[model samples]
Target: MKKQLCILLAAFLSAALLCACSGKKPAEPVPAVSAAPDVTSAPDDSGNDPAATDKPSVPVDTSYNPETDADNLYSSANTILIETEDGFYWCSSTSDYLLFYDNWLEEMIPVCSRPECEHFPDNNVCVQNKKCDAYLEAARHPALYNGKIYYIDSNGIPNPNVDGTRLGMRLFRMNPDGTGKEFIKNLFTPGYEDPQWLIFHRGYIYGMSPQTIIEQGEVSGRTSIIAIPIEGDETTFRTIYEIDNQGWGCMRFIGDYCYFWIHYMEGYYYVNWDTGEIIDEQQMGGVALRWNTVTEEIEILYQELLPKDGYFGETAWVERDGTIYVPGGDCLMKIENGERTVVFEFKEEGKHFVAATVSNGIVFARTVPEDFDDPYGKSEFWVCRFDGTTIFKGELPMDWFYESPEFEGLRGKPRYPGFVMTVGDETGLWIEFGAHWRSTGYNEPSADFLVRYDFTEDGGIEYKLYGSYDDIFIEPVD
Candidate 1:
């Protein structure tokens, strides 16, 4: 399931690709998605396959809330509902860089929104919906920081190579009510493809866009993360991080530092936001996932998963109290005062688990789907109180569907979510989704399709698709 990832670029920039090519070291077993256009033999599983190894399986919380909140979901949930002081903040991403993965991000976004579903109905996915249009996908992970909901603009058009004109993606700013539709920066340039992510830090928005280079006229190499000013003109954009001869394995900004892990065959390097540092070039040593600076300490957490070669390990996480709460992954180890009691079962192989940020003392963990090997598909979510006593397994809203930004018909979308935080205000959540169609295949239907579903039914399940593409419009959900 490897797909293309788009990074937004703010300035007209280029990097010097002049690595000696001789001093490169051998690769360790870090999980990486290759640039290959198609799927390869399953690289390393993120944290499942119990029979292969005996790790404590993720605790299965069988909580159910079927009538209202579909706790036992089977398919897509476009609007990721989050509780808040004002109301529920629906988290989502929309961007055009999705063309790289054949709509993978478009497909994946729905998964994050709903998580659990027996199976998503065919032709029901927003990107390829029968008649629905106005489907917006994510350019970068949607960020909730300092009580502001941040996302980039869906300004890009089909790539000229893919289409005929070189349409580009731009960054956008909006208040929670979808009010502030302003162009923070124009991310389209001749050399830079698109910017996909936006991270807020020190009152500035940091983002990354990888420049595509055709090696030997076809092979792809190198990826980089650039920075954008959340409050300035486009000219002042800064490309804070870059890596040579590697792919962007994972990127996230924790607190003041922006973390980018570049995974290469020989291993990976950690690109730090603070001090403009790229110094930590550690051999992955076969540890799953790269430069996992997601936690407070990188080296300590790395060795714990590894400990030794003959053993394999995995670690799962939950950000609580500003400190990353990693239970365990490949190998089993515990640190930090009795807080994280990582046991053997907490190891990767046996238990399959997925978690979101903990709020109000409850950590939300989604169960793995049964049909697909990937738990990400057709799964359900459960709330496990961090106190270590109760798990509230329940269903999400009904009739929800998910698709990645790359999904056909979906222009901007990315799946790896940024973060979910409940603000002080409680919200009346309406997981609004469905798209407006542009046209029929090939000819490019001009019809714009738009539809929506409200979980609480404040607005009944009213939607439209399969008509003139021009008819599509995102009418405000009341």
Candidate 2:
């Protein structure tokens, strides 16, 4: 009996050891987790349509009183709203664009102020009975470069921050205030990709990406330099040039005969968009050739935008004082005398802007941490001056994308600004594509529609409620 008792005690001790082994220091408390980060959803579709409510006609007061309708202002949710029939940002109207934010759905208002409104093509395109609705995305602080509001299609075709579904982005055009819209139908074949290389300039919009859209099994190569006329909806587009298997990034115009680019993703490869010919292919180098209309030929200039060791990634090239400028991994480069000069040095590695542009004397750049959930450093923006001065260092709220510990699921995402473009000194344009994403909430729009913060006599304003500026978007004005 004593022997039996000893064996039982030994078994008990073993069991106790097993239990202790599984405990694991209590798991460091496992901080509460959330679904993915996304804004809340709009309350509900309560549009005051005549067929539904048939209430007395009430005109939208355009008194410019922020104190009365502060909630509608995009400063908190969307400062402006665009009204159209297709739901959000749709239609071929490229003038008289309206911008506005309503109860929850940030609106892309359509303007009927033009003579063409009386005979709008889309008005009767819905067939004899079926109705074709109009939609428009908001275009605040719109910029009219070539008879069209310079805008980008912020469709989340390839949002890299999340998995499962990839959100894609494209460029588009609209009226200055948000009336007319001419969709830039991207020639995306089945397996096509832009690699985030698109920009608008000199009456034409251009970019390059990989594709399998048309000739599916044909090597998946044949990258091309596509050019779309800036003449609105009726504008014809064609593939100006094609590359067998070259990757593309940001591009800059050199002159009538030349264009320049930094392949970015893998190595350095530049192509002349005008000729669709690669100027050169080198594993490592700095001197670049940019063609300026005024100069008329490819000129040798120094470019420090490419990283000798690490990948230079994507960039936005802008012309300033007849010189070319760009932002890269940890520095900003100026291409002047056929050599790159590091005008500004980024403080930290992996902390850089995905895109940039130049307007006035300030260097408008969008800097993000290479690691989305970067733990060691700031994860938001690194806006800097041409002289490398950080003017607006507003913190980006991307943390809402991840939730851990408690559930550890993606919050999906609350709808937020799809793209950000600076129109002027203080005003910027924000686009919401009526984008409904998937997440912890099971496929749905963001939870919080309009974020309410400080309450004035009119309404309160809140931006975080929409989501962080950089999180809800990918790149480009589109």
Candidate 3:
């Protein structure tokens, strides 16, 4: 069951397994996909899951249709979509209209010229179909700059018959409205690797190459941080940094710096983007360090054991201003000048922090009851002021797969919204929400439900659900 969920949510699995080391916490008890989602575990008869609850008398409405819905405030029908400064874009698995939401008019505009044609089978429009010579499969990891959008045009799986030089993933750029699309460059040569991270800054794109084995038959692979010239040929892209690829971790680029880590045991690093220089490094040693990206400095914010014990806890941390807040263990705490101050401690015996973030003077956290013992338990969302005053705390009514009572035991975990792109003072979260599952596995090949959480609302957070897409990438408008 654990393996199956990892594959189901491969994008978030890295943090699922080693989030203790990374500052980013989980928003739900949903276990990360360590591998492909196809792996399954034995059925458990004991109802020890925290996330499970009796079927409620009133079922939450989780579905929406973009085609019929006219309201701009709320819509549930369109899935696999993204919103940028320019407009909102959604790629459908069924429809021919590669949809775009006009930011100015506040309406969805279909970009395809062929009124009768389903835009998918024909890649002439927004999507990268199987028919194209480069054979663009799906668009992933999008970034926006100037007036154009850049993303990973993932070619399908490797073909042994194809030449090595021609194989590997490609970066693509296009207009925000899904016009003037073109390939940028192949991510790697003569080998295959998926990007763990992608960032567009200062007229260049930075990506961390996928892990490769240290040696043939060895488990781990060598990893590298790559930089691509936005306007240059493939030769213009270069490997800025390289290290042993620690499987099941992540690298993130913010401003002009990059934060990197592989797993709990391997430690972490802060690198300078402009010079490809190592700014600082820290070993977890059972301790998690908080880097103040704003101040360009690092601090040891949380430790599992006392200095005498010299150990670290699995707790998670987030930074704002110069203070570090941790929301794991029994109590949530704020660390200042090496002092631990209690903020909001969990009175409940079993719940702990799954994920958290601080933006615009507000702290948003997701927690789950630990008593259930199941990897994914019922999750609660908490919103509070930076001072630790609670604003709102309630169950995050997100059930990705609507499982019947008979199949309740086979339900999937509650997943984190993967794409949390902070735009100025506002924050947007994009991730797969609901699931359509069958006896064998997921009912659909791709995520059926794409949910967006808009934390920029005046009163509180607002979310919209979109469904049934081959692939989707959302980026904040520049």
Q: Whole-model Cα lDDT per candidate?
A: 0.31, 0.34, 0.39
| Pairwise lDDT winner, candidates 1 and 2 | 2
TM-scores for the candidates: 0.40, 0.41, 0.52
Q: How large is the C-alpha RMSD of every model relative to the true structure?
A: 19.3, 24.3, 18.9
Name the runs in model 1 displaced over 4 angstroms: 1-84, 91-151, 154-168, 174-181, 188-195, 208-213, 217-223, 245-344, 347-478
Query: What TM-score would you give candidate 1 relative to the actual structure?
Result: 0.40
Residue-wise C-alpha lDDT for candidate 2, range 43-154, written one tens digit per residue: 1111223344422342222222211111111111122322222222222112222322222333322222232232213222112111111233322222234334455544
| Span of 10 residues, lowest total lDDT, candidate 1 | 16-25
Best-to-worst order by TM-score is 3, 2, 1
Q: What is residue 443's positional error in candidate 3, in angstroms?
A: 5.5
Q: Which candidate comes out best when scored by TM-score?
A: 3
How big is the RMSD of model 1? Answer: 19.3
Candidate number of the best lDDT: 3
Model 3: how far residue 212 lies from native, Å: 4.4
**Candidate 1: count of backbone clashes, pairs at least 3 residues apart or interchain:** 108
